[model samples]
Target: MSFIARTSLALSAPNRIVETAGRSLAYRRFGTGPDLVLCVRLRGTMDSWDPLFLDVLARHFTVTVFDYSGLGLSTGTASYGKREMARDVDDLVSALGLTRVIIGGWSLGGFAAQTFAALHPHKVSHVLAIGTMPPGPMLKPPEPLFLETATKLSNTVADEYILFFEPDSAASRALGDASMARIAARTEPRDHPTPPEVFLRSLQASIEPSGPFPDPDDAYARFYRNTDIPVLALSGDHDIMFPVENWYALNDLWPTLFVVTLPDSGHGPQHQYPEMSAEIIASFVRHTAAR
Candidate 1:
């Protein structure tokens, strides 16, 4: 099957690093316009993102993706906690001298993005969360299937389909295959995968009854409630991990928050609908900035 040819730019972007707080942080930058920094998800490195999605975003913004400290090729202490990971984002932003940026993430990275925007609101121009939940109790806890597939030492394309695509939709599965092919097409040097022990630690932390944000006064919740900065929670209608309904439930409480739901999709809407996802994000940044 033939795939779109636009993924080449993201596939060919070179790996680079910056010194931050005495540690070297691994990253890649491509595209143009304002800075947009994306944090990777649990068990993910910069290499895990779909090239088609990244390339499309590159057309609108100077996209940056990176590895958390001590994970992948970066050197430093690593912790899966959202607050700790937010520090990584902060250090990277400061190290790059980016005065302002659009902060985005997927899954666990979404948790980090939320925390970073809350902790350092001045640095983030907007918040874009893909296939992730907001802080506090979720409308639906993660399904067992996600854990069964996600914790594998290495995932096959089938496992990826289960973890990211809608199992009940044939079209979504076909798109998932195409996205996997686009990711595999990259021949450039890539970041190392997160170790099993590290990812297991994250899984354990997430499954605890308290969840990612145990505090009653979660920073993300408070930030969403009051901040003037626009927050876009992008998700699939049937996500098994972080359900999109959770975001919809809080739409009235957050002042500058919006939700975008894609039907017949699951956890990775950006991968299944790369061009549409990028356009939604670019439009969000553009229209919201005008307000």
Candidate 2:
């Protein structure tokens, strides 16, 4: 591997910007091989990702993580709606001159990833989602605990455990601690956190049903069924926000969907097991790539 690709620069990679769609998007690009553009979760900035996870992904693909408009270090209006967010990803991809790339995200960002693929299928090679819900109504609703912990102005380690990792598991809690430490170890200038007010507005927007982002004629389940693009949804055994059961319910409906549930994991499977998660993602992309 080359120096830029081999060296884990997730902690120190210079932040870059590109003018797109009347906004200046702040992003970090690292790794090698295929392009992997990962969107951030709700109330998350570019700094929210675990450094170890990015480092592991860097080994196999050129990864790009960015801040959504009006959040973190980016400029312009921000909308929590997935279609609107997908527009940001599309603009960034065009500005970067990337032809086809794997679009991925965590939590709310996952919604944007799926929408982006549905909207601009020609520009996407694969859809990689983590800790996100399936389309249509869920078999089970999100736990109340998620909203209580997620909307906090600032989260403590304990709050993180509850929100991301399996709080009751000793092993998961330890992994969560390590992941948080790795994230904190990035001493370079980082993006700012999503403000409490902005995030609160986002929370409301997410709850208010805004319909499908795919096609006007296609509903939520129909979009997944018709889309031919390969999708990999990585989740935990217990996700307080968007449970794995919801995806399982529609397992046979999504033709190219691959779902993996990590044992003793929670919302942040990537954080709990960064190396394993990255390998799973890399393998998925390599195995699903076009011939």
Candidate 3:
């Protein structure tokens, strides 16, 4: 399907639910090629993704987007740790009968994607970590202002702009606005907003530092270093949450790691530059699969 075609479908795609791990997990599937399961960011539902971005990805792959258990339309208790979240993804994938798939995660989802690859390397064909930091001590803490703003129960458009877009650039702000509009386009059957308590729990699980790395060389060598799967890590150069330098440092350690930095973007590079992000992801998936 073409990007436009997929975008249209994604805007109207029905939300599907599957019973996995004794809970009903809400998910959406689009596109028509190899399976690509995308994990949602912290406290975000499947509807949190931008339609334009989803459409671009759906055009080239079978894109699967879903909410974590107990969040959005999904039913069950939520898990805070990345490993537990990864297990939930494994259950969802197995419930769908997908044997081998590429997994992509954004933000906290990126953490889950990395854990999933590390824990279930045989089942995952490749890993795409976007706007994420590597696991362990080497990962930098997010700015205090970003964290404080993000934790607010209700965020205005201006607040969202601070979190997702580069504040100094009007073009980036415009993209952020457009992305929010696309995110809001899915009107009917919308997901239930994540409760404040659940949101806090999940957020804490993701940001709490994983410290006590005795070996300097292995500070960031927990999951990604152990997995042989082809890995692609992308982030905006101006990402305030997880800086682009983190990925560069990661690549320095693991030379095989593929890293891309989108110019002038903040945390949400995919939202800021959907077309470029989609192209990079699609091309990488194709090239890696061929290998």
Candidate 4:
């Protein structure tokens, strides 16, 4: 199917429920090829993704998107820690009877993806982490201005622009506007907004110190280092929240890691540069699967 057609199908796709771990989870699957499951970012639902971006990805791989427990249409209390979040994803995978899947996680989803690969290495074939930092002491906190803008319950278009795109780039701002338009297009049976308390818990879990890793500084190192699984990490050059430097440091730790930085973009590089992002991810998945 064409990109536009696939995107429309995704937006209008009926909700599918699967019972896993004593919880009813909502999920949607699109396209065909190697299995590629996407873990949503903080405060995001299954429908929060940009249609164009998702379409671009769906064109190349079979993509699965789902909500965290207690968020969106899923049932059960949400967990804050990435390990627990990873477990939720693993359950979803098992519920769907998928194996040897490629996982693409954005922002907080990236953390969960890493944790999942670490905890269940046999199920994962490749890891693609976007606009995320490795769990370690060297990670920098989000900027005060960015944090203040993002924490607002009702963020204006300007606030969202600042939070997702580079402030000084008009082109980037235009892409952000287009992304918002696509996200807003899913009108029927739209997902419920994540509760404030749940969002706060997830954010706190994302920033808090790790509880499962033996060494916080080497949390991800133990998982990806010397592993055959191809890891592709990408970020926006102007990401104020996690910053591209964090990803750079992560690549430094694993020399074999494939890393890319999208120019003139911020936290949501996939939204800002969907075609390039999808192309890179598709290439990485195909290359890794061929091995």
Q: After superposing candidate 4, which stretches have Cα over 4 Å from the reference?
A: 1-7, 139-141, 205-219, 289-291
Question: Which stretches in model 3 have alpha-carbon errors above 4 Å?
Answer: 1-7, 205-207, 211-223, 289-291
Clashing pairs in 4: none
Better model by lDDT: candidate 1 vs candidate 3: 1
Per-residue CA lDDT of model 3 for 22-120, tens digit only, reads 899988888989999999787788878877888888889899988888888988888756777898899999999999999999988987887787778
Clash pairs, model 2 backbone: 32-62
TM-score of each: 0.94, 0.93, 0.91, 0.91
Superposed on all Cα atoms, model 2 deviates from the true structure by an RMSD in Å of 3.3
lDDT (10s digit) by residue, model 1, range 1-291: 234433367777888899878888999999999899999888899888998888889989999999998889898877778887899999999998899999999998998999999999889899999999898876678899997888888888788888999977889989998888887776658778788988787567645467776657576687678889998999998889898988988889987888999999999999999999999999999999513
| Window of ten residues with lowest summed lDDT in model 1 | 1-10
Candidate 2 steric clashes: 1
- What is the total number of backbone clashes in candidate 3? 0
lDDT accuracy of residue 3 in candidate 3? 43
Q: lDDT for every model?
A: 0.87, 0.86, 0.80, 0.80
Model 1 regions lying over 4 Å from their true place: 1-7, 202-208
